[model samples]
Target: MADYEERVKLVKEQLRLAIYFAREFMDVLGKEKALEIIEKAWIKYGADNWKGRLQGVPPEDILKVMGEWFKAQEKVRSELKVVEATPERLSIEFTRCPQYDVCQEMGVPEICQKYCDSDYGAATLINPKLKMIRDKELAYGADLCNHCWVMEE
Candidate 1:
């Protein structure tokens, strides 16, 4: 298994490659079409990535489980803070995101939003009632990324 630094390097490399391919597609297919395809692909990627992980979790416990997952990742990949956590909602603030950093360094910060948008699909896949809301993002120049997960009424 790769160590933390190695894993981080790998993730950054993946982001760089994704940007490269996205730019290539933009050149060949046009910007709008390329972005549309990229968004759809990421949404499906998000859903498929979480396909079976949350299938067995009860609706009431979904937020709790998600909160724990975020907490566990606080120092591993990003600087995170659990702002609020309850049975119905989980809110977290990411002060640092490697994805955003890599994207910005590559001069294509907008790509980070594509990655961020994946959370919505991932949430819905995990549980139909789950919704992900993120108003602030580091990639868009916000100081932090705020992610809130809530159960639908």
Candidate 2:
């Protein structure tokens, strides 16, 4: 438990630095261009990582594997809550968010727009049929974040 907590803390700290970097880019390049750069980077990076992980897995098994992967990463488990998990979909509500927290701390919570939007690029790389819909986010001044990952037939 202690080790897991430590890992979570480490992950949170790294996320802080990542958002800080995004904020720096925002300062230099402006929001629009910085977001474009970040999104492109995430597309390649997310594709590489997901392709490697999902390799050899059948399309039918992709959602299961992806769900398990998401759960494992959410293991430190502070901000996100699983609302549902099925072969067709995985739904989650983010009640607390390290990214939002860090951005708030830095007084640039909107920086999260660049970071969160990358998820769409990464999800597409996972599977063309896999779609992610997010309705709200704390960074946008919402009460919480709602995310749904659905595997379309």
Candidate 3:
């Protein structure tokens, strides 16, 4: 298995390729159309990617599952700080994100928002009764990314 640094390098390379293709699509399809396509594609990808992984998770355990998921990611675990965890809610703060860092380095920081929106799709597929909230993001010039998952009443 690759170490965290190697994994981050691979992720950065993938983001670079994505940025390149996005630019090409924008040149041919126009910026607005390209962005629309990118956003929809990522949303579907996020939903499809997490649906099966979260299939059998009970609504009451959703927050725990999400926390575990983040902990499983080496890079995310390094930057993730769990602010609170309970049966009703889980709040986390991430001081850094490789995707946001790469996007900023590439001079297309706004592109990170399209990728960030994928979490909404993931949350919906995970469980309709669960709500995912993100009020701040490093990708959007915030000091940290604050994420909360709550079991809706």
TM-scores of the models, in the order given = 0.84, 0.77, 0.83
Clashes (candidate 2):
0
What's the lDDT for all of these models?
0.79, 0.76, 0.78
lDDT of 2 by residue, 68-151 (tens): 877876676666577778888988887766666666776766556656777787888788898889989777878998888898
Among all candidates shown, the one with the greatest TM-score: 1
Instruction: Tell me which residue pairs clash in candidate 1.
Output: none
Show how many residue pairs clash in every candidate, following the order shown: 0, 0, 0
Candidate that beats the other on lDDT, 1 or 3, i.e. the better one: 1
lDDT of 3 by residue, 1-153 (tens): 565566668779888888998888888999889887888878777777776677787777777876676656534356778887777887888888878878777877767778887677667766787778998988878999998888887
For candidate 1, write residues 1-153 as lDDT tens digits: 454557657778877778999889988999879877887788888877665556777778878877777777765654778889888889999777777777777876667777787788877877788899988988777899999989998
As for lDDT, the candidate ahead, 2 or 3, is 3
Best by lDDT: 1
Q: Please give the ranking of all candidate structures by lDDT, highest first, separated by commas.
A: 1, 3, 2
Better of 1 and 3 by TM-score: 1
Write down the lDDT that model 1 would get. 0.79
Regions of candidate 2 where Cα sits further than 4 Å from its true position: 1-9, 16-24, 72-76
Pairs of residues clashing in candidate 2: none
